[model samples]
Target: MAEIPANSLRFHVQRLPGHGAGPAVVFLHGLVVDNLSSFYCTLAVPVARAGHEAVLYDLRGHGRTERPRTGYDPGTAVRDLAALLAALRLDGHPVHLIGNSYGGTLALHAALARPDLVAGLVLIEPPLGGDWVANMIDTLSVAALGLEDGTLHSELTTLRRRKAARLAATADALLNRTSLIDDIAASRPFTPEDYGRLETPVLAVFGEHSELLPGARELARHAPHATVRILPGLGHDVLQGGTEALRHAVLERLGAVAAV
Candidate 1:
């Protein structure tokens, strides 16, 4: 539980030091109810144990990171990552980014926006360009309206689900009070052309049942260095439901990076 100041915010980060010779790995979490803890408990430790430095930090307005009322778009997110790496003196060497859901999209943007800092990418169930941006905004907007009165938080609290209650409160504050939804709505989600320009190695994994699986196939089709893997009988929750397979996929990606 270390706090690092970067990009005008204090970010909660867990840096698992590794005995590797070079190249570090950073874990980016999904939007809303997710925090760095998701990866801290999963791939972070595994990556660190595999002898690669692993850095896991909560994104802006999520987890223990300071929440601002603005700057919730993909561009700001990518800048935050750049600033964080610079603050940690990790900008000297290219690092691998392992992102889940919205985090994966952010990682892709990072590679496109600042290729000098990224060595490779592991995107898990990322919702690529197109209707996903609108769908996400609509879902958040509806949840904001439903949570505006705080009934959901209160009910969760009354049910003794402290964790759920806390998460609901977090979501409420971010949705109703911040500019997140508006920023997302204004985003130009990644297109095939955007993917085509990315030369960094990418390993995108999706669940067979996930509606976003098409995004992985599209990425593979566009990015010359991209590979797609689909796990059957799973959906958008590959980070959780498909943990073991996901772990193997992550390690394999790291191995490939180390080999090259």
Candidate 2:
């Protein structure tokens, strides 16, 4: 795990250098309880093998990154990504961004903020509209309540579920002890108009059964040149379960972008 100073915080960054002169591909993981390991295990290696430098990092307050009290909003997250790219000296280069869930939201914002820096995008199951933050807060609050009631703890202990226990504990701390919920609630979401104006080539991949499929369809409908793919027999966890298909789609898009 490598650390770098970005956005006034130390970020956990990992880089896999590629063989040839291909574009740099950055992988952004989902929010809370997710880390670069997900991408590191799935797409990062394959991307590197495809002759593209693969960069993966833990977002603020996730994985091995510094867990600050505030600055968890999309705007701040976009800034952190920009700062990370600059710190890595990838500012002027047209890099491709592959973001999962909330990470996809940040990628969209980053491309909007600095189109010159982003060449293409791959968004997997990004929640675009609705009260996603509120829903997340409600879910976390319920989990925290369960933790306090000893229900979750007792179940985990009885089942010897070490991983589940650790993840639940982490989620409890992040939701109850920090300003993550507040920051997410206060953040602004992009409008349909915003999506329609994006000039960069975007590949939006969503599971056929995912609730966010509507949002993905909307993005494709609005965005000038966006491609949407629906993977069958999958759900919201497409990044984990549909790695082979996602990898193929991403590499295909990267190849298309490189050809242009």
User: Candidate 1: minimum summed lDDT over ten consecutive residues — where?
Assistant: 213-222
TM-score of 1: 0.98
Q: What lDDT, from 0 to 1, does candidate 1 have?
A: 0.92
| lDDT of each residue in 123-205, candidate 1, tens digit only | 99998958899899888999999999999999999999999999999999999989999999999978888988997999999
Clashing residue pairs in all predictions, respectively, total 0, 0
Error of 1 at 71 (Å): 0.4
User: Of the candidates shown, which would achieve the greatest lDDT relative to the real structure?
Assistant: 1
Predicted candidate 2 versus true structure: per-residue lDDT over 147-209, tens digit per residue: 665567568867999888777766666776778888877767668899988979999999989
RMSD in Å for model 2: 1.9
TM-score of candidate 2 to 2 decimals: 0.93
Once fitted onto the true fold, the runs of candidate 2 whose alpha carbons sit more than 4 angstroms away are: 148-160
